[model samples]
Target: MLLGVVLTVLCLPFLWWYFFLQKFKSLSAIPGPRPLPLIGNALDVGDTPTALFNNCAKLLDQYGDIFKVFIANECKVFIANADFLEEIMTSNVHITKSNGYYLLKPFLNFGLLTSSGSKWKRRRKLITPTFHFKILDQFLDIFNASSDILVKKLFNEVGKESTDVCPYIHLFSLDVICETAMGVKISSQEGKNSEYVNSLIHYFDIFIVRFFSAWRRFDFLFKFAPEYPIQEKYLETLQKFSTSVIKKRRLEKSQEVVETTSDLGIKRRVALLDLLLESDDLTNDDIKEEINTFMFEGHDTTASGVTFALLALAENPEVQQKVYDEVLAVVGDETYVSMQHLQDTKYLEMVIKEVQRKYGAVPFVERQLEMDATIRGVHFPRGTTLNLYLYGVHHNEKYFPEPEKFDPDRFLPHRQSERHNYAFVPFSAGPRNCVGQKFAMLAMKVIIIKILKTFKIIQVPDHKPQLGMAAVLKSYNGVRIRLIRRDTD
Candidate 1:
């Protein structure tokens, strides 16, 4: 009798689950990798970040643009079709981010990137104004100053064979975000690594590891695991750094009078942190989450974008010369790259756009369906997680002919008009797209124009990097470029 009772209790849950899954019989008709009886296709999923990324690519190739895969019996639909992506991105009901983003909760703690519902809506409203054109214009000075330091650092390696520009650009971006976002200067270009920065990198690495490992997804198991202690240590480091900066900035704000006018009768100075601090609806913890989010998003995304842009320029000398010529024509030996210069360098902008299409810093965006919806006549039930494969879409030959080739002309005004709006979404699309995209583009233009004007980037021979998936898209081996100094006329 005892044995029968135990079996009946266990069978009840399984029966319930089996019946629950049956209601989604419509989704079962969608083709995907064959699943095991209980664990489904979870074991077939890759164990490492790179493996997982590669597996997704392979599945897309085999299963076509839209297909399903079971992650421990939960059906996930991967969509690479541009139309489907547009439908998903534009839908108001599907605005909530996927559960996968919850992995960042321990780090970001309901920052704009991870929050949902009314909190996300309110936070988005509060933060959107911080990246206005006028505000970002003030940050140009910060961008130029940091670029000057980066150029000086690179000059030390001029004509001394190939140097890995990845670390240098990473530090340059770090400094830019610090000054512009946090209203503080870390001078990371000086080559002195901070504990905060080291911990930041370590935390991202740990997050990726934990994200891919099924065993670590369970809170109880991950908490007791050996990796948990290391993760906690880095988490503490990040929290400590962010909180300290917030408190320091708060103290400064408290001491200063609220100035409504500048020397030129313009509006007062605005920093990202200041905007957050001024909001009555937010607390110190809210400010910290946003600070950490901006620091991570603003710095790392641009770093990857700029690094890949440099790599592309190095591989294509003709393209590099064109950008250099455009810079010279636009700015004409001016030590400073102003907003006018940024606007006038149209060719350089196309090159950057092409680079983003080929190597977007963010490879994918995930969304969870809040209600049942039909995308291109296919039904997706509520609670289904959708992975919008931006990278795959960018590489799809149907959208971009000869996708492997680096061609900036693809983004010419005429050419862009011919393509689908959703085809090239490096910053994503629709309402929840990246808020600071303009700021990022302006910063990249300033730095790239500085570097290209100073030196001709040369690609190392036989050195195509194998990219790995982390929080951002990164190469297993760092991006190495040889710099040949340009003749001063």
Candidate 2:
């Protein structure tokens, strides 16, 4: 019986390879670090987020723009070239996300970020209008309110030796997303503690761990792994939180008679949840899926962007001064940042673009080809997984000369015109691109501008971001900086 089990296990890889041999050989022309039998290039990718990030960059340098890696039994082709990126990103047929996204199903289910085909199309159509200019304009109040709270909260840390700003940013972002998406604020910023936030961080840690684990990729094998139970625990916690919020919001909607008035007789501002609830086509479950999706994507991605932007500003005082001067010129002494103010800060916008180019929140995205296609004379069979390495693409020397330098001028009109349109896709591209990208950019500008207005961010001695790429790009070592009150400074 033991011999039989061992033999079956050994044969599994051979069986998998036997079926896909032709498809595998077709990709042999693509350059990559050589793969070993069965496990393939699994070990080459690294175990931790930091190692994985660094190793990926090294692989890109060696393999050039496009490369192949066999992570266990799965083959993933990493594409970083702008021209090739344009072909794949613009395709309507290759919109299906890779299998790795399945790990998020426990938390986000098949919501907008993970869903595909007709379901994704319908949901995208239904939710696209929620981010319209008029609707987003209504969110400025929420942004200003949240920024005020964040500013007040940071006042307590102004004189501290070095503050880790990531946590504070996370809380502030959670507060904003909760209000904008759900119509209720949990005051995560005020409370200064959140299990949901902690759970989210832990969830990403587990996901990254599993995402690179050869054994954990299989359900049957992962059942025995230690992360399984822990993942289930957090999944239950996350689900309960989302479920309770959706139920409460639905009850409130059910009890309301007037569309513009609340039970307290106050005028009600529409939230994403309110719009979703008004839809006749969706059930409470469908709404929960979307709510969870938005709550995670809307807040976390924005927080990561703002955190990195601050880090960039801290390290580059000249650039920071430029931004501060720009902000002063645009909206001097104004507590409320208007839509026009956000649009007019072209220099600050350029800085944000540079930050994204260097440290995009979602560093990489994955997709699966729906049908066979050829690019640059290389044939990709149907169902091949493609890793759109946005970080690699943004940092490629061909797109931006001296890519490591923090120069916002690269985004200058004439310079930007020199690069491929798909060269810097921080929010991704094509039909399946992020729908809330504009919303995210506006929110980030609001918080960052608000902070810079009050404080001069100084970098901690020798502090640098130890990069990591989980679901989002974050620094494992924390973003540490000192803040001096601008008035006192």
Best-matching candidate per TM-score: 2
Clashes of each: 0, 0
**In model 2, which runs have C-alpha deviations exceeding 4 angstroms?**
1-21, 262-265
lDDT of each: 0.84, 0.88
Q: Please report the TM-score between candidate 2 and the true structure.
A: 0.94
Candidate 1 lDDT over residue span 1-489, tens digit each: 999999999898678667656655678767788866556677656777667677877887788778787775467887788998898888766788887787888888889988878888899999999888988998998899999999999988887678888889999999999878877677878855487777777788778877777778767888987889988998998898778878877776787632454335655456789878988889989998898889878888999999999999999999998998899999889989999999999999999999999998988888888888887888888888888888888888788989889999999999999999999999988878999899999999999999988988999998878786656788778898898888742
RMSD (Å) of each candidate, 1 decimal: 3.1, 2.3
Candidate 1, overall lDDT?
0.84
Give the per-residue lDDT digits (tens) of candidate 2, residues 1-489.
999999999998788766765666889888898777767787888877888899899999998988989876578898889888888888887889999898888788999999999999999999998889998999999999999999999999988999999999998999889888887777888874367767766887788888877678677888899989998887787788778877877777787743567658878778898889889999888998998899878887899999999999999999999999999999999999999999999999999999999999988999988888787688888878999999999999989889889999999999899889999999999998888899998999999999999999999998888998867898999999999999998
> Best by lDDT, which number?
2
Cα RMSD of predicted structure 2 = 2.3
The CA lDDT at 295 in model 1 is 82
